[model samples]
Target: MINRTKLCSTVVAVSALLAATTNLDAQKAFNSSDHYLAQPLIKNIYTADPSAHVFKGKIYIYPSHDVEAGVKENDNGDHFDMRDYHILSMSSIPGKVTDHGVALSVKDISWAGRQLWAPDAAYKNGTYYLYFPVKDKQDVFKIGVATSKSPTGPFKAQPKPIEGSFSIDPAVFTDTDGNSYMYFGGIWGGQLQRWSNGKYDENGSKTDLGKADEPALTAKVAKMSKNMLEFDGPVRDVQIVDKEGKPLLTKDHNRRFFEGGWMHKYKGKYYFSYSTGDTHLLAYAIGDNPFGPFTYEGIFMNPVEGWTTHHSIVEFKGKWYIFYHDTQLSGKTHLRNIKVAELKHNADGTISMVETYKK
Candidate 1:
């Protein structure tokens, strides 16, 4: 009794209408901008030590986690003992977050069978490299490298640690000359070295680069072997000390210098950003070369609302931005959350930090 041809046509029209409505809903969701700057992007209930890198138009964050309810706990009573790194990737635009859960886990690799912390990732050519610090049961901390063909990856580590150095907080920088270097170290001191093939050789060492009274900041350039891990340059020191000298102190600790070395190039000059004092406020210096004969610029941002900050900076979509962590959320473990701000360079050559917007 019913006309089959008419029924089929009516079904096709209804399907097309539904498809159009669904597309419009998606477009609206993607186009709407919400203020995410003050909100945690991922509400895992525990995320810290966030490191962000933009690869192929996507923003990837590798953060350290302590424990999650559903996850099994190690003997230390932590869900994961900062021994594993997790990757979360999202669109650079607001309202677009795509989490590839637990992209890389230390348990997946035998070499770094213990702990992973402070992960930094960079992409070159068709390969993505993740640099992070690991620890074995012996409590010896070392830096390690993993490579994947994609940003969201099952990263594979080398047979052993990369430089064979007792180092932590590894930061990778590829300079204007196409040379790559790794700057690391914290509570002890920080070092800058050339990275080649798969190794790091000390081009220069800073026993006390951030000592408040030091006259100048110094750095020496070195070459590594084809393996890209050995050093071939001299150990040089550049002067970086303030003549007047301001003593940095915290409630429970005496302040020295050194921590979180992040560098960027703008308008033909290089800026090296770091943190200092017991409060861990953000500070910076400028040098003519990546290796420096540098001068301390001064503090860019101090603790706001009694929260200490760490150093992390990046340039996104032609705009310069600084990404640092604050203790406002969780106090005990430095349950650091990432905050961004626009960076402004003053006419007098000083820089200012501005709070970031999510929209």
Candidate 2:
């Protein structure tokens, strides 16, 4: 009963409408430049465990490089070696990073010898201090300190290792009272170490602030002696047990939910972040004090659909944004790409993970 001409017109109109709707959806998905905003902060260089510190308004990213591969040669060809720390700096831009040249190189340090991994840079007074771990020919690892007047530096390593302990992943935190502390540990009995005056105790122990269900330890604000390396108060033992009171250490393997420990204080509370699992997914806990009776805060970000995630957190910049690494494009090479995304905290303080880029 419908006219042939009218039926044909109706079919054409519906097709045109569908085409217009598809075009509009595509425009909404692809119009924003945010999808194209990612630029390599560091180049073809495979870097990992990136930590950023803002000094004099410039951001310095100190990462462990595959320096060994850069220097070694095999029968077929030369392989990239990860034997040194590579420091890169950039000016502050909301969504961009400008590659400042190599701020520090291990080959330039006299005592490094070989195998410098996971360097952390921090500025105090008029000097920039880089805390990094290095291994000798025997493969024994130790943490050391290097000082420079500038962040991008020809850094000079201390004549010897700090306290002669086999440690790596050194992170330095300075309290409001001018006291400095260093936290470093991995599978090999990870423990927090403190420094005061000019002398450091290799046997400096950590305080065991139990989990949230337990009583919190009294927060201490101690002063450093003239030596700048020794602590004045009793160092407490840090508990590495989970909520069920079980040890976090894995007997068969080394690393047990313990690597890349970072602490930040915000609004009078301190947050401790670390990496866990064989895949190194980012996990965190919160405490009222730096030496914490911390409670698990849950996973900030897990491995994506196509990539593995690790060593990351949200930085407060007007709003909170998470920074992490992804390996979707680069295979198992550890040549990971850094990503940033806004983080939304729930009423109960839980965080929601969102896509790093707009697309």
Candidate 3:
């Protein structure tokens, strides 16, 4: 939680920014060679936390629809009080993006509270599954699933959130063998710090344990059942360690998992990339297994103009592109615009660093 004064200031600041930017023209077209300065893919309304995927030979993005809700800011993410979702799709990068409006809303979800956060999509057995994290009636964030026959959809959210789910940022990865797993967690206002004991503790530390020397909080992972509506097993911690197999300490903020879990496979290695929230870097680790003791690699994306950097990576037309957000659209931390950049993987299975805000 935050002081009332700080909260009011944040809300007023964001509202002022929206007023100034709502009438501005859209950004320039994307440049693959220099995507650090790439233009936003959507401009009519604010969006952040892009979860890009390719389905049926087209690019689709599932992101939180950013709106000026006038809610005050706090460590519990009160200021980011988004109410609904919109689906974005394009046949190609640097092309026209179509906003398939109002996929799902709080009013339509029976058990949902407010603030629907970042979402991801998966296609399985002729059905498209939309996975998202939203606060329940009790104000606890729970990951939920929605379904649609079309990749772009007005999805029908399930009646309840997944039984064993907790926290936010749901990234689903289906491996080569047809098995699926979800990686999720976020700290600070995201309420991830409250789940350190494998269960919710309302009085838990808002940030972390304040133990800089101790291992940092781990992200959670679990396999999805065949129905894709439930967890097949117990949710487990995802260990991120150094080359020598030491857990990243709480003080090592630059390279630890914070939020925005994106799992992609390259040449037989499981690449688990995530946001280092407070430090604002996009980092990745690799392991031989999906349920990883992943070895820490290095930072891939530097900070954008905003305080939060959430992203997704997908291969489109045999070329890899990363979808992420920055504050350039509104010059406000709460309001953001999504952008895309082409990614390159080295011969040794290493990724090239992406400097988002370059001179």
Candidate 4:
């Protein structure tokens, strides 16, 4: 016969042991600061295309989560194959990166393929909108938006991708007048595709690839609707030209907008920032207006020891930062990790160069 008192005691002891173990696991999961002890803001995972924003009082970063292919059929080390995104945040305290779990994943997006790329977040009207790019079944990359009531979210993506967008690297800029604009594109001439005839088609004409050193098409910018679900107007090519209306270029044959396009408004000036291709240096141009005849400034950061550098600039608590990624942690060209460094703007409105952090 079982003794009731002894059985009750044994049950209580087992319950206590299980609770303790669960608590320890929770602590370990939330201990993200421990992983970010190195210069890279995150560790143990590959992160790329860091798009940062100052929401409420903390700095939130939206970066594409890079996972190396483990399945024998899925191995393609040369190509990018990010499948999800993780939101990382830190308060005023430095060196603390709290992983906000999976904000959105390819599985959540019905129209999207597995190539989940760069993403940016914006808060408006009590809702947070995450603008991201994903490949569709047609093998074309399309930009889409997701929403969440909280900055950190298991975001719900819209049923359809943004109608007029057919490129990658979607960055949104909200002006003081409450108007918003989206800038996005990628390599292979950096042209914006249009949505016509029930499909995304090329814009205007293609660039001459033979003239690689000459300035080709820049990023395409369009006014977004108030809800940010659709485009308000035609997507136009960004004007990167000199006073003579000639397309400008760097000496080494790089387009103004190769992959990443981040816009920042400061002191009534719109800074169009992007990554110059091949060389992989962060550069920018200054424009009086968002869709501007921007004057090329120069490189903001020298090339890191990586093949790519996609980033975003944000100001948190009066200090500015440039969030970017490199291949330091993975020790490979494709698997990158997010990193950040302090940025300074000169009195003339030009930004100072950001050096890679080493600790």
Per-candidate Cα lDDT values, in order, are 0.53, 0.51, 0.84, 0.75
Listed in order, each prediction's TM-score against the native is: 0.67, 0.66, 0.90, 0.81
* Deviation (Å) of 55 in candidate 1: 1.9
Maximum-lDDT candidate: 3
Indicate whether candidate 1 or candidate 4 has the larger lDDT.
Answer: 4
Pairs in clash, predicted candidate 3: 75-189
Candidate number with the higher lDDT (1 or 2): 1
203-226, model 4: which lDDT tens digit per residue?
A: 532322333344565678999999
Give the Å error, residue 312, model 4: 0.5
**Where does candidate 4 stray beyond 4 Å?**
1-38, 70-78, 189-208, 213-215, 243-245, 249-255, 357-359
Q: What lDDT does candidate 1 reach at residue 148?
A: 86
lDDT of 4: 0.75
lDDT ranking, best first: 3, 4, 1, 2
RMSD of each: 19.5, 15.9, 5.9, 17.5
Best by TM-score: 3
How many collisions between residues are there in candidate 2? 32
After the best TM-score superposition of candidate 1, give how far the Cα of residue 344 lies from its true spot, in angstroms: 2.4
Candidate 1 accuracy as TM-score: 0.67
How do the residues 1-359 of candidate 3 rate in per-residue lDDT, one tens digit apiece? 33555644654465346433432311221223243468778789999999998898899999988888787766677878888888999998889999999888888888898789999999999999999899999888998999999988889999999999999999999999999999998987778889887789888877763566679997999999988889999999999999999999976777877889889998899999999876667999999999999999998887676668899989888899999998666866688899998899998899998866445
Candidate 2 regions with alpha-carbon error over 4 angstroms: 1-39, 67-81, 93-95, 188-237, 240-256, 304-316, 354-359
Ranking by TM-score: 3, 4, 1, 2
